[model samples]
Target: MKKLLLFVIVFSVLSAATVTFWAHQPIIGMEEKPIEFSIKAGSGVRSSVEQIASAGVPVNPTLLGFLARLSGKSGRLKAGNYELKPGTTPLALIDQLARGEFAQEALVIIEGWTFRQMRQAVASHPALKHDTAALSDQELLAKINPQYGKPEGLFFPDTYLFAKGASDLQVYKQAHSLLQKRLNEAWGRRDPSLPYKSSYEALIMASIVEKETGQKSERNMIAAVFINRLKRGMLLQTDPTVIYGMGDAFKGNIRKRDLETDTPYNTYTRAGLPPTPIALPGAESLEAALNPAKTDALYFVSRGNGTSVFSSNLNDHNRAVNKYQR
Candidate 1:
């Protein structure tokens, strides 16, 4: 019985000593990572473990196997983009994955963005990559392949979450899908008296509404002004559409010449809705377009602030424009 007790003590001491040695060996592959190196999504522990061992850090894979078995672990690894600090042990890293500790990237899509703007935002991200800007607008439009016209007015204005190595196309597709669903839902519930002939027309007006006003309270009222003009068969005369027609060369401001330009998108010349949406519209703009406030307003001008003053006739509109813009 005494010999048995002595054997147990020696075995326990050896086990503790072994654990201590491994614990102090400097966690594998963590030697050079003082600056927090990221483990991109889809990377596995094997590569990281190898990197650690090559950095002169000893790894006890047998011990890992033992602990894994004891914990009933069935290769439970967290699937996400991870960033780890220097001197992190393989055991510690595995524990993090097991607990599903991963990083989330915030992606914000603002209102009034063209599809190109949305594409550029995703392409320029540091953790993701895409040849979005390299592709022409036509080519990017083809990638999304909306049932409607081009991808304009087809991205939701909201924040999205992307993990490491997420594709730009993936995020764009998500926003596009959401936009389509929301627009379709709103179109189905449109007021029968709204001047829109179809969902497409509603989308066009919504895009104009998105560009025309940023004030939440003014959207429906501004929409009413445009709807009244449409019903009267007068030209939309939206300046933002003309700016969109100018495309890449449209510096920061619009000139008198740009307004008179004979482009399909120049509502000042075209006398009706633009050939396509000038920008992506959000849910508020879509709702406002579908169910505009009932008003006799046939014209509107920027209030020089973030809002627009609505008018019922050309004379009143010109007067408001002179008062505010001039």
Candidate 2:
């Protein structure tokens, strides 16, 4: 009986030593890269460890789960995506999971899209929690900011990265806050001689410039044209604002009658800037609107490809229009 007791003691010591060695062994992989792992919400510690074992981590589920419970970390498991690196050990996995370290997901907002398009992109993102899916534009605008009644041109265009499964509201707030910061900074440093009465008017001009920049190199020139026209008491006559006013009636093409139609956004029929921005403007367009190129150009027409020809007089503008538009 004494010999049997000694055998059991020796066997238990060897088992503990084996477990301790396994806990520190690094999980190497092909090309020594990291492996992706996920733990869904409500997953218990046992199931989570089983998932890790199945993710090619070279682990024993029962042993890892036992270790997790033994180390008093079973109740601290979090749900989200994880990047298990090349040197991650079985013990480190438990600690990493308990800390809720999640992989980031990205959403890219294009520069010239309207608020409606931006909302659609946010609502359809798989990684977002879809908390704002049912909210209308006006309703969502209220939640984002109450002072701004209209939603157009309020968001900055850029790639936003966030942890997996983050709420959609989090993204909106981040973008909104960043845009305000940039706009305020840009407004504070704007040129003193510009025609804008307020930063919002500059933003409105920036949106027009964003849409009209068929050739990125011509952004400053386009701003110069509008600025000259605004200064000379001439009609802006920009087609993009006219198209924006048409709304659903604009079938991808603008007719002469469409130009004649009266709307708050129709630059050809109305005077001064539009009531609000037509699209989200990027940094270049915003800068151009605030400080245009040093030129007398007051007219431009598209040259068929993505560029335009600028002219300072009506006769030259008409000649260029006949050369290009005809």
Q: For each candidate in turn, give its C-alpha RMSD to the true structure in angstroms.
A: 4.9, 4.2
Query: Model 1 — which ten-residue stretch has the worst lDDT?
Result: 34-43
Local distance difference test values of all predictions, in order: 0.75, 0.89
Task: State the lDDT of candidate 1 residue by residue for 143-258, as single tens digits.
Answer: 88646557777678888887666777778778878887988999999998877777888888999999988688999998888888788888888888988889997999998988
lDDT of 2 by residue, 1-326 (tens): 99999999999999889888988888674468777778888999888988877877677889889778877999999988887888878788888888887777899999999988999999899988998888888888899998887989989999999987789988988888877888888888888888889988999999999999988889989999999899988999999999999888989889999999999999988999999999999888998898889999999999999999999998999999999999
Clashes of each: 2, 0
Off by over 4 Å in 2: 1-28, 31-99
Worst 10 residues of 2 by lDDT: 27-36
**Clashing residue pairs found in predicted model 1:** 28-52, 29-52
